[model samples]
Target: MKVIHVGVGGFGKQWVRVLRSSRKVRVVALVDVSEPALAAAREAGGYNGRVPCFTSLQEALRAVPADALVCSTPPDFHREQVVAALRAGLHAVSEKPMANTLADCKAMLRAARETGNTYVVSQNYRYRPEMWTIAELVRKGGIGAIGQVRIDFHKGVAFGGFRAEMEYPLLIDMSIHHFDLIRFVTGLDPVSVQGTAWNPAWSHYKGDCSSSVVFELSNGCRVVYDASWCAQGDYCDWNGNWQIEGTKGTILYRNGEIRLLKVGPRYKVESSETMAPKPPPADSQHFVLADFMRAVKNGRRPKTDVYDNIKSVAMVFAAVKAVKTGRKVAVLDKDSR
Candidate 1:
């Protein structure tokens, strides 16, 4: 497959490298608003200054034909870019959040449905071995019916960009990964969200760097989350420390380890097992890329297709609403997917 990659800088730089490494696709064209970034990505992407670079996706599409369009642009630009790519009959891939708002997300999904083009949001965090193990375990009844979930995430990041300007930096920029991972592992749709987002006086960013939210899942599971992007110490994994409790037992992942606890009477831990994650060899973008390729080949919707991923993005928007209004907000309002 031939690919046209847009926004080849920062995180896009990593996307360029992943694209170069994947044998399933060839980078035919690169697009970026920054000439310097295009040059840098050209080198880092191992295109050897040979692939054509354009200032816009439209310009690239006008000049070259490609099987897919991979966009690493900000969420603000995703709707327009992705809709155009899908309308042009090319499979579209995008970095997370889908779009800035639920309406825009729905528009992108509508375009895909109308065009019959594949639209995949790269929720790469779900492709990890540990995530797959958790999902498989939950699916196979290893944990029985989930009842409660606890997640804590802490990270000290100073990305001197738009992130600093977001009102809920930790919730909007980082929480999507955890929110999507929860939905992926548990196969539970979020029903409602109630949360608070705050910023510590010690924080450097102009936005709230910490958040606490409780998501009511479809199965009445309560997912309690506490996260901080400007944390000073005791940083957790980027995927967060997860403890999902169910009727049978609890499955937990912390410090890069997966463990299962089998419960007995009165929630007594009868036995414990350190599980070795059994997933495909590829991970993160590598694994997502492979899945996208197979879905394209089979003419099926990819795992994180826009139809499904919008729900996860809705979790973020709903949390933001809950924070702004100080009230519980439905993850999916009267308008159902």
Candidate 2:
């Protein structure tokens, strides 16, 4: 397959590296608005003078023979880029959160629908071995009827670029991963959300760096998610700490280990055991790219296809509304809104 990859700085550089290593696909064109980023990506590997380079997506679409497009641009530009790619008769994969707003997400989905092009969002966390285990357990009733889920995420770092200035940095940029993960694991759609966003006085970010959210899922499960991007000490892993409570038992996942505890009759303490995670199928990015390619070839929707992922984007928007209004906001589906 021939590909056109956009954005070549920061996370974009990583995407370029993945494209360079893929045996089934070749990057035919590189696009970036920043010349410095383009030159730096060219210097990094595989995409030297042989491949065409453009500063604009429109020019690349007109000039390149691209089978698909992999976009790593900012969330705000995702709608324009992905819509253009779909209209150009190219399948597209975009980094999450799918878009900055629900309206933009809807527009992107509409383009894919009208063009009959495959559009996928990179919800990479769903591909992890641990997540796979959790999903399987929940699906097979290993944890019984799930009543509640708790996720606590914390990381202390400084990436002083677009993130520092973005509003609700923690909620918009990071919580989507966990939100998507929850949806994937429980196979439940979110019904409503109540949230609060805050930034500490000592924090460096201009926007809110911390948030607490309550998500009501379709299965009558309540998920409490708390996160902070500017936390100072004792941080959790990138995937965070998670606990799932069911009628019969509870599943605990912290750091890299998974544990299951069964409840005895009459609510007594039963047995607890550590569950082993399955070997990962492949690297997360590779899994996503391979899935996209397979979906395109088979004329099927990818697992993280935008048609379904738009709901995850809706969850983000609903949370934002909750934070602003200090009230629970309904998660509106496509037909309703």
- The best candidate by lDDT is 1
C-alpha lDDT of candidate 2 relative to the true structure: 0.88
TM-score of each: 0.96, 0.96
Q: Compose the digit string of candidate 2's lDDT tens values, residues 1-337.
A: 9999998787988888888888999888989999999998888855679887899999999998888999999888899999999999999999998888778888898898899999999988888888888888888898788899999998997968778999887788888888889888888889999989999888999998899999999888999999999998889898899999888888899988999889866866588889898745776778899999999998887899987887787888889889989999998765423
- Candidate models: Cα lDDT each: 0.89, 0.88
Clashing residue pairs in all predictions, respectively, total: 0, 0
Q: For model 1, how does the per-residue alpha-carbon lDDT over 1-337 read when each residue is reduced to its tens digit?
A: 9999999998998888899888788999999999999989988987876899999899888899999999999878999999999988899889998887778988998899899899999999987888888889999999889999999998998877878886787787789999999899889899998988888898988978888999999989999999999899998878899999999999989978999999987979999999998875688887778888899999887889887898899999899899889899999864434
